[model samples]
Target: NAGVTQTPKFRILKIGQSMTLQCTQDMNHNYMYWYRQDPGMGLKLIYYSVGAGITDKGEVPNGYNVSRSTTEDFPLRLELAAPSQTSVYFCASDSTGFYNSPLHFGNGTRLTVT
Candidate 1:
């Protein structure tokens, strides 16, 4: 089974546009995270959740976040999009909360805001 999958591998958005980047995992993980990577930069956290119905903010403010409501899906929503939001976004999940638990990652969704 695919550990994790992200939809719309590439997308383009206009200023003020809004979109949801879909992330799903078949591993039934309780921990999930969203991250964005800019050119020549490291991954910047966007948001994360320890389990369904719980979510926490990260460094970047993509927009308001929501609880997964299900362990298999975590969608990142971007509102009032701007050029600065352009980047490759990644979604990851860990079966256990342990620091050393293996992380499963999606291929990544590339977004461009014009």
Candidate 2:
């Protein structure tokens, strides 16, 4: 099964353009996350959902939004994109109630806001 898949592996957006990074996991994990990595800065959680119809903000929530309609899908939306938002976005998921379960990650979507 495709553990986690993200669409549009790369994209470039204008300062005011917006886009949604699509993520889906086939493992039926109960927990999913959206994270971003910047130069010299480690991964920062953008948003996460413990389950369907329930979501929460992470370390950096501004300029971004997320929705978890099903355990298999989690999409991250970027509104009015900016240069500051340029980074590699990743989607990950892990099964709940399991300590040793591997965290599955998408290949990552490289977004550049020019």
Candidate 3:
């Protein structure tokens, strides 16, 4: 089964545009997350879902939104894209939120806003 898959490996958006970064997992995990990383920096959580119909904003949720309608899918939305939002976006999932639970990550979506 595909652990985690993210579409649009790369994207270039003009200012004020909007986009959705798709993320799907087949692991039936209860916890899913979206994170973004700027060049040469650690990743920062943008949004997360504990389970279907349950979601919450993460550390940097200002320009994004997320929804988890099922255990296998969690999609992130970006509104009014800006240059500062240009970064490598990663989708991750884990069976548990514990520190020892292994986190599976997508290849990453590289977005560039001009």
Candidate 1: stretches off by over 4 Å: 62-64
Model 3 Cα lDDT, one tens digit per residue, 37-96:
997889999999989999998999998988888899898998899999999999999999
- Model 3 stretches astray by more than 4 angstroms: none
lDDT of 1: 0.90
Write down the TM-score of every candidate.
0.94, 0.95, 0.96
lDDT of 1 by residue, 1-114 (tens): 989999989999999999999999999999999999997889998899999989999898556364598999999988688888889999999999797998788999999999
Report the alpha-carbon TM-score of model 3 versus the true structure. 0.96
Best by TM-score: 3
Return the number of clashes found in candidate 2.
Answer: 0
TM-score of candidate 1 relative to the true fold: 0.94
lDDT value, residue 113 of candidate 3: 98
Clash count, candidate 1: 0
